[model samples]
Target: MHCFKEKICLIQIATDKEAHLIDPFEIKAAPFFIRVLESSDVMTVFHGADFDIRTLDREYQARVKNLFDTEIACRFLGVRERGLGALLKKHFNVDANKKFQAFQCGCQ
Candidate 1:
């Protein structure tokens, strides 16, 4: 989850157990989540953010105030990159190998 300006973006990577319990109703009723959506300065998330925004809108009637796409950021940065792993390797000097790189793909 991240907030920027008045927008809030939440990323939920569910494990097998947690994934099973996931439901639209529970997502809406989660009190803490509602609070985050209601009160945030800004939100920045990457690819497929629309899906998340749609789900939040459908379940809780929440609306994002401001949004920044990290994938777009990488492009604007002119690093000739697309995925998080490559960007991380370029900017953060992290050695994200093929195995871990594949795992990082789901982040966006």
Candidate 2:
């Protein structure tokens, strides 16, 4: 459960070198898929994960283990703006505009 539209849609997997966008709608779930997500070894990271986590359970019927969310981190740090865009600008000095957060996805 990486990227989604309505249900789980595009799953983005990244390594040190590259990233892959997997279309879950096209691929049937592999046997170890849930195991992979719930595994204790790899950490699942998300920013503002409320919808994403809920979608994974409600839509994909899976639960994630070892979850880390930047929004939660921001809250832990006592930041007023816990949004990804705001955190990025404050901590990393990256200015990712907030206009696209509400924009519709999976459309031209």
Candidate 3:
């Protein structure tokens, strides 16, 4: 159960009103989100969702429905640079924040 040892530290959700940063460790109700992820009516968009999808299944038994992966879409659309930062920059003229990329989550 190597995957069980791993935990999702951050779950960011953005709505028209505001953005939410949920710390799974603090929430302790991560499984509550499984229903939302599994709902076919709700579409979840991710830049690259392979790891996230696998992790959700392994950790909470969540099988996401109506998933739209931007990376895959970009590839299908013939965008050469598929990275999130690159795509955002090219299309929206905005820089993707990588500030927390180096932050340690203590999973290992």
The per-model lDDT (C-alpha) reads 0.55, 0.73, 0.84
Candidate 1 colliding pairs, count: 8
Per-residue CA lDDT of model 1 for 30-86, tens digit only, reads 665555555557454445366667767775677665666787776677856677677
- Every model's TM-score: 0.44, 0.70, 0.85
Q: Report the C-alpha lDDT of model 2 over 1-108, residue by residue, as the tens digit.
A: 324466555667676789777767577763366677788897888888888878878765778898888778878889898777777878799999667445445443
Q: How close is candidate 1 to the true structure, as a TM-score?
A: 0.44
Q: Which stretches of candidate 2 lie over 4 Å from their true place?
A: 1-5, 29-32, 92-108
lDDT of 1 at 11: 40
Best-matching candidate per TM-score: 3
lDDT (Cα) of model 3:
0.84
How high is the lDDT of residue 29 in model 1? 45
Put down candidate 3 lDDT per residue, 1-108, tens digits, no spaces.
243345677888876789888988778667668888888988899989999899888878899999999999988999999999998899899999999764667545
Best candidate (score: lDDT) = 3
